[model samples]
Target: MKTISKWLALVVTVFLVLAGCSGGGDSADSGKGENGKVQISFINGFTGGDGAYMKKITDAFNASQDKYEVVELQEKDHYTKFKSGEYDLVVIHGNNLETYKQDGLIQDMSSVLEKAGIAETDFHQAGIDTVKLDDTMYAVPLDIHPLTMFYNKEFVQEAPKTYEDLVKINDELQAQSKDLYALGVPSSGLVEFYMLMIAAQNGIDLEKDGYLNFAQPEYAEALMQFHDMVWKDKVSPAGLGLDGEFQTFMKEAQEGKAYQTAVALTGPWFYGGAKEKYGDNLGVAPIPQIGSQLAAYGNSHTIALPANVKDEEKLAGIAEYLKFMYTPENLINWADGGQAPVHLPTLEKVTAEQEKYQIAYQNSQQFDDYVSAPQVYQFGEQIRYMNESVFSKVVTTEKLTTDALMKELEKATEMAKQIAATAPQQ
Candidate 1:
């Protein structure tokens, strides 16, 4: 009887351990929705006013069908969450696609896109290209946001068509003593982005084969032009940071100040604030042709799937969700949050159907000709640091010469190369 009691006790302990392990496994798996709906977790960093628009879309999608339901995880560092298998889908910056692919973190979506009947030709070529690597597509482009020009229509008759025109306008405005300048330049890292855009327009390559090459004459010329704008032309102030410039423009417009800035260089997201402040005076246009050709700095947001999402049913559900989101009927909904759809068909539809902000939509379409800066993984911060250090000094203190800036760029490039070399191989 004593031996039988001991055996019963051991059996109970083993059963309890097995049950606990099973419970842990079940908790890690995705839960089913009512009537066997496949629940998919989506993670993104859209915690601003845009979040509401995203939620609207998600709710609409949920109501449109009963097979799948999307759960949003809004937070910063979405990639980290995705790695933990808590989310099956992520919306990330297009530039990060390459790095994620190299790390084998994202799944190749060519098959998924094909299954959803979405072709590469269906999207804006520039946007589609951002998510492709060596003929393989890994993500779907959601929207294109480019650096553009916004002007006060009451002061400026029309947008400046060329670089010379910009200077002339500034000179004329300053002479009128109407308190208006030709342009309101921001003293921030974005100045470097503008310089890169000009360099690209001139056919100068700042990055070549995973290396930085700022020794080109075109780069120097672009820098010289920026320097002239600040110091020689005096059209823009010396020390107004991005926030200061934005506030100055808004305050001047609100007060009906005749001497307000005529033009401001910013992104599409600025439309809401500018419209609120300027009312009917706000005018949107592509950034003026600063170099030999028309070019602007641009980037995109993309939807990507993680490699861990291997379930066929889940993939199908995700494909359907994406298809729904990109449908022509729903694409225009993104405009509510100031996002320009990356789908070419949707863009055309918006241009024809949406008249309230037609110019803003048209300007966003110009991103097809825009140039994206180099996106070196784990090295972007270092490059930005170098750019800010050099550009801020040049714009504010006028102390860094072109030669000194070049030397500093070379050093930064060397440091970037070293970091790249030590990065883990995919």
Candidate 2:
């Protein structure tokens, strides 16, 4: 319900371009030239209605300062273009950063910050961790996207506080012929790996120090529960196509069929839909815990000045702007598109606008229970595979088990290592 100023919106508009499309104007104005504005190029993967909101944020920033200008490019082609020396700065998901860094597209941020006299200790530990490669920083953290649970108030007034509670509610709903269930986890091979993070909140690790941990009893137990949810309970929909799963899950939530879902496991964009659809009827909370701790999916949108960028002052301005973005005021203003901030201190302070975001924001705190999978490239893909493969074996395939799940995870981890090893060195 918060309205963004026009200038900030413009920046958001230009940064949301996906990697393969050409949309929007190719406007380059750095506040100098004829109009006396500074121009900087920004690229991101917003690519949807969220792009419009991002643009609003950009427009606001541009209007506020004449020292620098930002030229927005559809980010779909940014990585390719960034490697080719096309932009001044880029905002992108941290998971793909390894590939970029390995290829020498983005400069090591820790080195840049040191050269710029910025201290790493100043930023949030978790936030910094999201931007790391073997403990070396490569990007500035902008936001941390984590899984949040959104459920229908009309169908289920009391949201589950734990995973077991969700199962109980699902059973109750089924017995009552409410035909409502708990969640519609994604069906992708990577999904299982993501689920491991959920399992980790309970002390399960699928891979540790580059070794397979899926064979652990805790890991297997956690996966079996997921298998039970999909197969034995039949809480989730069957034969739902992957492409439409997100939409279908949201639709069911809106229609009061399913009670909850793990959609948008990495960002806040998912909550925007429910807010628009259900208003006060929706409830957002950190993902429920399974055993002794809580965990949720976590990923990051990283900030990095491109190697080709030469304007020192402009880069400084951006650093200042990054600082501003983390403040409660600016963060609340720009908490759309599912990208939640990683600053715990800033998050603790709240306002009415932010309270709406709290539904998703609060749950993101549990992300530490599971290392931001994106932080580990192989693990991220492994999660995607885990979620899908586990769900399929349980729901669709009906042959999923603890041992089977372990093998799948081991195989995926090996594949991830292979990808990392073969990746071009930066």
Candidate 3:
């Protein structure tokens, strides 16, 4: 009898110990909050005013749900951190989606969309198309920021309706020696984007058979037009980089100077800052017809799940969080942060609201027509090199002709192709 009793006691002790170990292991592996709510982190580069709005949305999601907790991390290099497993999801520029998808750093989100009950058609067609590579969805687009025209209402009663009008305004401004120009052209690599916009307007395809074709006549014409604006017409201040142009415009506007930039070609993100400085004097309009058709440069912000996150529960949590973030109500909050909503329903709501900057919102609606620059990996660096080595010379030095700029562009294209070839393949 004593032996049996002792065996039973040992068995009970061993079972209890095993159960406790299993419980601890589950808790450690799950990384759940109290009550088994799955914990996930979202990484993004919303360090400006948008960060506050993102935080509010995140907090609202946390409060509305008990099954998941989303923690937001604001970091500029979100992709690096996401690859390190620090975040379950990351918001990347729409341009980077292709690079990330090709490298297998981010996973196809079709399953996530299905699980979240989101159809591809739910978002703006342009935004949806931006994140799709051959029918495989990789990211959910959040917003589109298109380069639009910001004109000084005090200087110009109506926005320029045509390219000739823009040039005439600049010519008039220069005649007055008013220290004001019709436009502030940024020489800091933005000239490449401007050229792309103009090329798109002329129906010139920038990419052909996986190669860049900037040696085309349309590109040459675009280059000359930009050069003339800076050097010959002197509409743009000589040697004015992006920051220099922005600072000059903002300073003049803030000081109520008679001679301020008459029109600025910038993105919707600048609307908030410009409105703050110029108040009602700031006007927003679609980029005037620069080419045969109206086209401008634009890009989007997107949310994507990292490829390293293989845990189903964590992925489910992420999908839920994204769905919550894109709800019509939450998207309105996103718009309040100066982002143009990408969800179709939210866009409809925003259009109806009309309480915010109506001109900016209306201009944003035209993003579908905007042309986005090619998003090849390291392509931005190649463009920057072209700007500094080739385009800058044309604007600053009278000796460098448009033909010379075209030759440099050809070299840049070759270098870009080499870089893209070496970049990670899909």
Candidate 4:
């Protein structure tokens, strides 16, 4: 009886030990908020070369402090991981923020910022406005990525002040030689092409009355003119889609086959690539304007906290790291992506490297022509749909009809309205 009891005790003890091991207590908790170490996952959709620039900033931030650590998760997969409640903070583009906010994946940082004593004015007005909805701030913007025309100083020496001037130059270039197209428009660059053109041509305010009103006649006219420039005038490449449009133009520019692109609708990374590939031949200008309004299509990369992160000290630490990221000292490093800084005060005090990126940014006559906020979300898509139809027909040399295109625009706007209705608003 004693031996049997001893064997049963041994079995029970072994079972308990196995259960403890399976419970994962010994394994390190990736998110253990203990011992003054706060782990934050920084998420972004930046899978491009720009990711390298942001990584540089994040790495420095992590090393700068023992209290907080920022681990950047690259691409859409980052969000997938973040959604599993594995992250504390988010640093993503504005496009995905609204949905994230609605899904309760991200927390409202307004109260958090207030408690932390960070003034809203400490950041750029545009940046602040970009992340706020219905008087509640959700994300904090890092930079305003707007469209600028990067031109070749060799062929187009004089900056065209008006759309007429730009069109006239295109006419001259096209009339001279077929191989030397005056401008190239990306086929897949539907959203960017429409927004920049609308901003330059009519100065459409993307945000109005909590919804997008893109069916206005002025917007339609801009779309028609853009279509005319590409298809009717043969200025842009034919049979091109979004993927090939920029590459075709860049290749042509490098080979001296083209003079200038219709406009290079890209973020700051383009400037660095141009400097490396085509040195001194590049010039940047804010998208040109045809009217009194001079708004450009811009988007923001923002910072936010996950809905479940409840630590006050961790939130404070994250804000401090963000303050560091936005400061002039760190912004210069952030500018390695070749984008202009969001903080206007630091715009003038840049390093030599930043100046190289700023040359084109500073020359833009309509640098203030930026429309990078929540309103752009729906209207941007509608404009892209309209532009793609008109531009594609133009590129293929199809007959330009106002009626057919108008129908498409109406459908797109209606679709956008449906989407907006279902869209998460917070």
Candidate 5:
């Protein structure tokens, strides 16, 4: 919520349009403008509220320096545009680095960050590993958005840290009124939530299991913990279709009207809107630990050097921008944008002054078990298989039985294998 008005908030609507819709590049140009100040064009999928945060970051850099100007664009197809050689720097998801590297769309970033005075070790190891392939780095890690629980403060007096707490909170709310329920399983990040349970409760290792490792009974049992919440436990309603949890969480409760969906397990992106709607009533916490660990499933944003940019001037600008952006003071505002700063130095700053960034910037304890995507080129595809092919079907169709889920997993596994075979060798 702090980032809602941290810097340059006014006139953001106009900035939003220009940042998200504009396109840039010159085929014969060396990315250096006539003034001799290099122009570094950046592209990313940080559209909507996200676009404002990133735009502010780049805008600040542009104002602070005269030697370079950073222009950022928010494109739905950012990676594709980067591949077209129109952008020098682009932000991609941690899960996508492998695909980007394999396709030769980005160059090794092992030296770019180091040369900019940012140490690779300062980032979360899991985040660092996401950009590394064959011991070579391809991107500089930005922020981590871990799956967390957002609850209505009025409905639940305290955050649920354990499975028992969840049950008690659920019963207490339902006791007041049947319509008031404390838990609402997510639809968009269903795969991450499911994997978080298995890792915490069952201790399933991702590296050992591989990317498409959802066919086992243990995995099925873990997934059912959520499906049962909707079907058997009755904590959540059936057919909470795509992003229904978030939609309901942000739904403004009328005067004297209690929220139907009071609790949500979603990523940090929910903070900007939820805080606006619920204010201090919006509480955030690590996703409750059903077992021994509070390991949360997380995703990250990484700034990568697009391979198409060969201009030395633009590369210099990109390097300076990386250094300026991650400077602890400059990067702190990013957390106000509802992300956990994975850069260790910036992490220290956020935790040292919790209330300063307390709203949605997750505290340090959450990252102890925070993880990036599995080291597989098909990681993104595996999530698609689970979310669209398997998990979503369970929610929409109410096929909660283990045998039924396993059958769907088998089909998904075949898909996983087919895609792996078709992909070029690493």
Candidate 6:
């Protein structure tokens, strides 16, 4: 009896030791906060005014929940900081979805969204499509920032809805004020986005064989059309780089200066400043069709989880936060950042209240036609920084011809091929 009792005691002691070891090990609970909520470190590049707006949403989400505490950082260069993998969630541009996914930085979000009770059909089709790569969903979209047309309502009675309408508006503006430019065309900055719009409308296939199809005839035609906006029509002044066009548009008509730029093609980033300058005279409209088909330069801001954040509790918290932010009523406030929330229901709410969100409401309608960029690794680095874009050359080159422009495109095409080659196929 004594021998049996001693064996039982030994077995019980061993079992307790095993239990203690399992209890002390690292796990999803390690990230829990003092309040017993999982702490989700979220990061993004929404600096300046955009940061402030996103913070409000984050704060509201924190206030509305108890299971998760999201601590967010806005670095403007957040991508660099995110490389440390300390963050669980990050906001990225729709076009960069493929780059992040291919690099194994972000995870496929289809299952995540499913667990969160969010459906692909719950979001706008364009927004969903923007973040999808090769049929795999990557992130939940937050907002679409399309290039909107800003005009002076004081000078123009109504916003132009088509190419002919723009020409007529420009002619009328010229007649009324000979010194003012009818339109402003940025020679830099937005050149890439502008090309996307032009490329799509001209039926230029965006990507083929993992490279840009700039070597096509339709692309040349697109360049010619863009050149004509400044040279042939003489509606826009030549060589108005990004700053020149925006500054001219925001110039005061007061102080004995005639309105220099009656119309401008810019993004939501400039709307607040323009409104402050123009007051009620600021008019927002879709960047009317420059080609036979409607295509806008735009992309969505999406929320994604980093691949390293696999804690089940933390994932649940992230899902809660995503669903909360994506809620129609919750996301409607995103318009404060001069962007359209990609949640279709939220956009409908904004469009219904146009007086409060004119630019966002109008631009929201244009997202459906936005030229979605194809997968090209570090697309901005590969294409956006190139000094010799077809648009810039067309607008600035003196006595430029199609043949000469084709040669320029050839150089850019080769450079693009080299860049695309570096992108690994997933």
* Candidate of highest TM-score: 6
Report the lDDT tens digits of candidate 1 across residue range 100-199: 7767788889888888889999987778777876777889988877777778887788888788888888888777764667776666735655666777
TM-score of each: 0.87, 0.76, 0.86, 0.80, 0.86, 0.88
Full-model lDDT for every candidate: 0.72, 0.58, 0.74, 0.61, 0.73, 0.78
Q: Top lDDT: which candidate number?
A: 6
lDDT of 5 by residue, 1-426 (tens): 776675557667779988887655453255567777778878898876767777888889989999998877788877676766567788988878887777777898866777788887888786677677778888888877777788899888888888778778878877877666666665655555565445555666544333456677776777777777777777776666677778767664453453476788776676778888888898887777875555766777888887877776777777899999998888887876767777888888888888768743553457677755666666777657777657776665565688898888777766766665555653
lDDT of 3 by residue, 1-426 (tens): 999999999999999998888653322145686767888877898888788988999999999988888878898776676666546788988777777877788888889878887888888777877888768888888887776777888778898977788888888876766577888777663565566777778888877544466667667777677678777776776666654445556756333233457888776666778888889888777788877888766767898877877788887887888888878888778888888877888788888876683643766657778666575665555456566666666566655676777787788777767766766762
Question: RMSD of each candidate?
Answer: 5.3, 11.1, 8.5, 6.0, 11.0, 9.5
Candidate 4 lDDT over residue span 305-329, tens digit each: 7887776666776777777676666
Error of 1 at 380 (Å): 2.4
Q: How accurate is candidate 4 locally (lDDT)?
A: 0.61
Model 5 misplaced regions, further than 4 Å: 1-29, 187-201, 206-211, 251-259, 396-399
Kindly list the per-residue Cα lDDT of model 2 for residues 1-426, writing each as its tens digit.
135577778667767655235553322223244576556677876676566656766776777776766666666666666655466668767666665666567676664565545566645566777777777777877666665556667666776777677777667766755435566654652353346555667765454544334445566676666556567766665554453334544664434444434222323456667678778876666666655676665566787766555566666656655554555555554455555666555455432346666643565455455355444433444345445454566456666667776676576566656555554552
Off by over 4 Å in 3: 1-30, 253-259, 357-360
Collision pairs in model 1: 178-259, 179-259, 180-259
Clashes of each: 3, 59, 0, 5, 0, 0
Per-residue lDDT of model 6, residues 1-426, tens digit only: 999999999999999998887763222235977788788888898886778778888999899888888888888789888875467889999878778887889888887798888888877788887888878888888888877789998777787777777678778867766656667777887777777878777667868777665766667777777688888887776767765567778775443344477887777788889999889999888887888788887767999888888878888888888888877677877886777887877887897898898878888878778777776776765575344466678888768888887777777777778877887762
TM-score of 3: 0.86
Off by over 4 Å in 2: 1-36, 110-123, 189-194, 207-221, 243-267, 310-314, 323-327, 336-338, 344-354, 364-370, 377-391
Which has the higher lDDT value, candidate number 3 or candidate number 4?
A: 3
Alpha-carbon runs more than 4 Å astray in model 1: 1-28, 83-85, 215-217, 253-259
Off by over 4 Å in 6: 1-30, 252-259, 385-390
